[model samples]
Target chain A: MLFRRIYQFLIVYCIGLTCLLAIKKILVLSDYVIPGIPLILDTFGQVFRGYFFDVLNTLSVTILGQIISIIMAFAVGILGRKSSWAGSFVKVMAYNIQAYPIVALAPIIFILLGDGFISRLLIASMICYFPLLLSVLGIMASPVKDIEHFYIATGRMRWQLEVKIRAFENLSKLTTVIAGSATLAMAGTIVAEFIAANAGIGYSIRIALYQSDLARILAALFMIGIVISVYQGILETLGAQLKTKWSAPKEGELL
Target chain B: MHLECDGLKYTYPGAKAAVIDNLCFTMTAPGFNAVFGPSGVGKTSLAKLLVSRGNRQESCISTFDIDTILYSYNQERLPNWSSIGSHLNKICPIGKETLKKELIEIFKLKPLLAARFSQLSMGQQNRVNLIRYLLQEFDLLILDESLANVDEALRETIILAIKTLFPGKMFLYISHNLMEVAKFCREILILGESTKQRKNFMVRGRDYTQGYTLDKKAFDATMLEIMNAF
Candidate 1:
């Protein structure tokens, strides 16, 4: 099963790469140049190299920020579950954060953090935090009814209850949020790069737009799509494995 | 051990009245007891209050004293039984292997252990839910309509298994099923409907039993008499 999944992922990645190349070729053939611009094909190698490094930069920030945000969310979720007042407070805060538009918040983040990796990290984390936090909180609050009361009555500690019951019961949901947050994190990273970064794919796009280099811009967009798709694919595969391991088989199916 | 709850009063949020009002009851161990009433008479609430030791915030000034109470009302609350060993390990910890093997055999739960709780039929889920509690030691076991979905034969087997295996423990079988109550319990507590009046009454389970079967008509008549007397 693992081998098959890996094979499928490779096939998808290759197909996406081929499509990107094909689009690049079509644009090059059409001589689609902005007015007063020279038709320069010699800089193709430089553009590719720049795009690659920019994606790497953005992804590094995104991955780190998302990991921290997920941990924070899980912690908050547990705290909220343990206490009603804390749960209500966290829920209200999450709601306000979710209601606040990312575009509006972006400028404030830039102004506060001042155009660096810290600013980008903060932006990405904030964008990915609410959805993941809410999802985790919802799963935590989901009552297992008798089983939960049974645990409490049995004197199972909070962490023990979380691991033995909540974690196992809500494995699928947690995986889903992880996948969703990956996409959101990538989007946030790009938006942050567009707003504040001197490096990364978002910065590349900004440069391409300023130069009226449509192909470079297209390449950056395609690279973002590919990165997000690959990330989601990895998470989806992990989710499937978790479900198989933790979830019970359906009726009439062999384990 | 004895289970006791005194002056219990509970009102659901956004509701006009208390579901359980000024209720009091006590049951000693090594006993089979039943709490019965019509739907929405706070039978389930009483079970919850009992199991939680009256810590439910919805209840006003309710207090209960029970060392360990294991309660089950519905199948949906149960965890997936796929990893029965792991689940049992968390709740039982000691003697889990022996208890697991015993329960699987007595309840005929071996076949269903590998299945998800959702995949099992309601009867199967109910049986598993009840068996889960049996693996642990508890002062009071409040099964609030826990066996409603199980078939008669299997339910009887489970009740018999509990009787034989855990003779010293207390079992509070809360249900609207009069026949099951007649067959199992020696004492029955009838919860009253009125919030303003504490009209609860207790009677011997034999009073509702007619020969080999539960006399529903006789039970209803007695219930009516008790309600009117209050």
Candidate 2:
């Protein structure tokens, strides 16, 4: 497991590092020193401190969005399981959400809600809503034919379904959906900031652009990327731990 | 008809040759009846048909109208199937630890219930699943080639458990094990290529009187026979 994680890290790290080097080289070749490397790094640190709550506020929005989406998805999934008619509606709504880019709509949301934390939060929540719903419901609804017979012969009770049946699956599934939603919300916050607020990371990015301070802009962007990565890492670990707990112990794995 | 299927047929979505083809069978109330067939035959399919009834037969059909299924062949939406986890509460369902304890105690699913379905040694879940079904007081209990997944020792324990529970109920016991069929089932439904038929024989009575006529007609020659003593 450790090795698998490291390999995944190396693959992502190499690509990111190579792209940064190529871009840096291009800027230098064009006779743009931009700024000292140390100065860029210090600016990045400043960006982190400047909008730590911006990141938190955005994350909170993403989480709230996911929780709400799950409730909606689960309701529709259960209804679809029963009525067959509802499935088409669920599919249509899901498809419509997927087709329209939430980030593109973030500016409109900011326009409606007005500047700062609340607007960004609303934008992030809207951005995150669909994917979280789709992912959680998809896993919950998927049927495995092999295990059906067991339920038949034993006449498994209704309440018993969640424990032996649903928990293990839902744990991993919701974790993954929440992780994806977090990334979307964070990105949405940045885009929303760019359009509206002058306080958060996105606004900082705009200020750098206005001043022709390309290095500072990159620094702010890089800081946002770091926040996303760190959030993903925390979520990944949370997912794994929840999965381990939910998974029924294999006989050999038992004490 | 307590349990009857005439002109019953089923085919998978994209397969030829009906797993159950123009087959007809029936079972009376208050005892055990075993279904004997080779591995590829429609035993499991038939079991599904039976459980599909007591499970939610009314929602599917007003009565045991097997003809309703003739058109439903290869269709995704069957009349009788229930939604996923219909009984489960969507919000704040109980934890797995409690679920295992209930299944183990109530259904008699012990070590097997404690393991994940994927990690379980192949046949372990069968016993757990079977006992789960057994706990339900359905009109008919369908065991479609059910014990095929269980180990020999556990199979005996399950069979014994079923026998103990055999009061005022019927078992549609499906198996490829011909000797077990002969041993346990008094009324046997025999599925042939051209048609379906029945033969009544007791393991004790057949040897005592009929001189084991089904011995010559045994389909599973190499199947491990359940020793009558054990």
Candidate 3:
């Protein structure tokens, strides 16, 4: 699975590069407008090591932001699982918060927290939180009626057991959602850096954009694509393993 | 245990006519009773109302002296992530270990205990579902075609085992199978073709347990009576 993801990404990157070169040839564009193969390679040779570290820095914030979003999503999902007034209120409040554009909110966040790690982290989490919250809420709110009826009949339907049953029934769906959310987390972190942060690959891309350095921007895109692909691949592999271990427990691990 | 229904009436929401209209029955002892009817005759709806302690102001389906009335059906599914053995262990009360073991053996579910619910066949799944309910603490259990998918021979074995093991408790066995109900249940209530008929009647069954098997003639007679009533 990991190898497939990497090769698939490589195919897309090659096609995209081919398109840009074609466009540059047709328009007779200069190296600054659409860098040639030699110029892009030169830029990669000059800044590959620095961009690698910068991408790693962005990745750290992405991981932390994803963790925060997952925790927040689960908390809200559980709270809003039922149809009670409080559950509905929590759900409505989450929707309202998600409706506000993060880009518009980023300036205020930077003003309060400044262009540092905390602001980047908060922005990334906010950008990644809403979609995940919606998915969790959807899974949690729907009851697995077939399994739940037995518990209800026996008078053993506690809140914790109810939550576990729902979660266990939808483990595969939840795993897929979590793995898919990695892309959003990476995008969130990069967007944060692009807007205001002073560090990470996004900052490098901003500087490249200002200098009209297409080669540098292309190099940064390459780094971001490679790292995000590897990270998402790892997450998907882990999700598959978890599903296997959960569905087919060992002999003594029955309960 | 005594189950008495006086002026039992139920109509589903957004329906044109009542499913169960002015129905009534009385069972005075703890035994394997049944409600036998054709398809779409509101057997499941009646079971739900019985378990829910139906609207007292509209109808009185009273379970006098019975605390917990559990309704188990053929379509009920167990949690699939865990094995059948784990489900039984989780649901079995503290003092019912011996009973659980016996039920597992009787239902012939020991070999399949290590398997997940989704891995089992329909018959096996129903057996496992019934076993978990049997392990629970309930005064009255309504088996609404709970063994529908099982073969005739195994269903007989399970029914006999349940009757033998839980002697003093009450079981309301609902099924479309006439022979089993006539042979096993002490009293069988047969519902009419439609609610408009208002022709529900009760017939005494042979009440066969593990050791007692009535003559073939008497069994056939009771079966005919139940069929004719319906």
Candidate 4:
């Protein structure tokens, strides 16, 4: 899984770089517009270590933000699984909160929380939480009628068991959603850094954009893509393991 | 314990006509009783009404004396993420190991214990589904075509085993097989043939569980009576 993710990202990055180089050649663009291969290579050699650390910083925040969002989404999803008035209210509130654009909300959040790790974390969590909450809500609210009826019929149904049954039945879907949200979390952190933060790859990219250094930007893009890809791959592998372990046979199950 | 329905009328939401209209019956004895009817004759609906924990203000079906009524059907599913053994272990109440073991042996579910629910064939799945319910505590269990996919020999074996093991408890065996119902079930409740003629009533069945062998004359007469209801 990890190898596949890395190769897929590498392929996409190569294609993008090839297109940029082709455009640079056809337009006779200056080094400022699009750096030549040597310049880009030299810039990569100089900034590789720094950008690598910067991306690590961004990734740390992304992981933390994703954890927070995952907890929040599951909590809300479980609470809103029923079709009661409270559940409907929660659904409406979630949809309404997601309606306002995150870009527009970023400034207000920064103003209140300041352009620090907390602000970035909050922004990242906000970006990752809604889609996840929606998916969790969808999977939770939809009853696994086939399994649930037995519990209900036997008068043994409990809220916790209900949640476990639904989550287990839709484990693949939950894992896919979690893996997909990693990108959103990383993007959210980068956007936060680009707008105001001073220490991450996003901030570095902003500085490079201000200096009109296309080579540095390209290097930064490469770092972000590879790191996010690796993170997503790890998550997917973990999900697969969970599914296998769940379905694995129990030894001497007869007892 | 007695389960009686007086003027039971149930119409599904957005449904044009009542599925069960002014239905009335009383089950005074406990054994392998059945609710039998043709396709789309509301056998399932009646089963649901019998075990439903919903509002009873408008419902004429009464099982207030019964503590718990379980309903099991053919298409019911077990949780797929765990093996059938794990599922049974999780749901099986304490001090019921002997009963569970007996049921597992009788249902021939021992081999499939380590298999996940999705890995089993339909017949295997049905056996596992039924076993879980049998392990649970209930006053009356409504088996609504719960053994539809199993072979006739195995189904009969399972039915006889159930009748023998849990003789004291009540079981409502719902099925399309009139012969099976007539032979094994103590009593049969037949619904009307079609939606237009929705008559519901009860008929006595040969209690083969009571050491009565399959007498051809008695079985034929019972079959004819059950068929004539439809």
Top candidate when judged by DockQ against the true structure: 3
Give the candidate number with the greatest lDDT.
Answer: 4
- Candidate 3 residues lying further than 4 Å off, grouped into runs, are A249-255, B54-57, B195-199
Q: What is the lDDT of residue A80 in candidate 3?
A: 96
Please provide, for model 4 over A7-114, each residue's C-alpha lDDT reduced to its tens digit, 9 standing for 90 to 100. Answer: 999999999999999999999999989999999999999999999999999999999999999999999999998999999999888888888777678999999989
Per-residue accuracy of model 1 over B57-94 as CA lDDT, tens digit each:
66433323446777776644556645554555556667
Candidate 4, B76-108: lDDT as tens digits: 888877678988998899999999999999888
Residue A25 CA displacement from its true place in model 3, Å: 2.7
lDDT of 3 by residue, B44-96 (tens): 88888888884455557877779888999888888777888988998899999
What is the C-alpha RMSD, rounded to one decimal, of candidate 2?
A: 8.3
Name the runs in model 1 displaced over 4 angstroms: A1-53, A84-119, A250-255, B1-10, B21-29, B53-66, B93-100, B113-119, B192-200, B207-230
Give the alpha carbon lDDT tens digit for every residue of A1-255 in model 3: 788888899999999999999999999998879999999999999999999999999999999999999999999899999999998998898888878887678889988988989988998888888989988998999999888999987788998988888988898888888878888888888888999999999999999999989899999999998998899889889988877777865654433
Off by over 4 Å in 2: A1-39, A42-48, A51-83, A144-167, A248-255, B10-17, B53-120, B194-230
Local error of candidate 2 at residue A60 (angstroms): 4.8
Give the Cα-based TM-score of candidate 3 against the true structure.
0.94
TM-score per model over all chains? 0.74, 0.71, 0.94, 0.93
Candidate 2 at residue B49, lDDT?
60
- Residue runs of model 4 more than 4 Å from their true location after superposition: A250-255, B195-198
Greater-TM-score candidate between 1 and 2: 1
Tell me the tens digit of each residue's lDDT in model 2 across A1-255.
334444565667558656766776777633144555676567667666665665555556556655665566666555444225576577667768778887777666666877877777667666676776566456555653344333433334353463235434457666777766777767666677778875667777788788887567666655555566676777778788767655534335532
Number of backbone clashes in candidate 3: 0
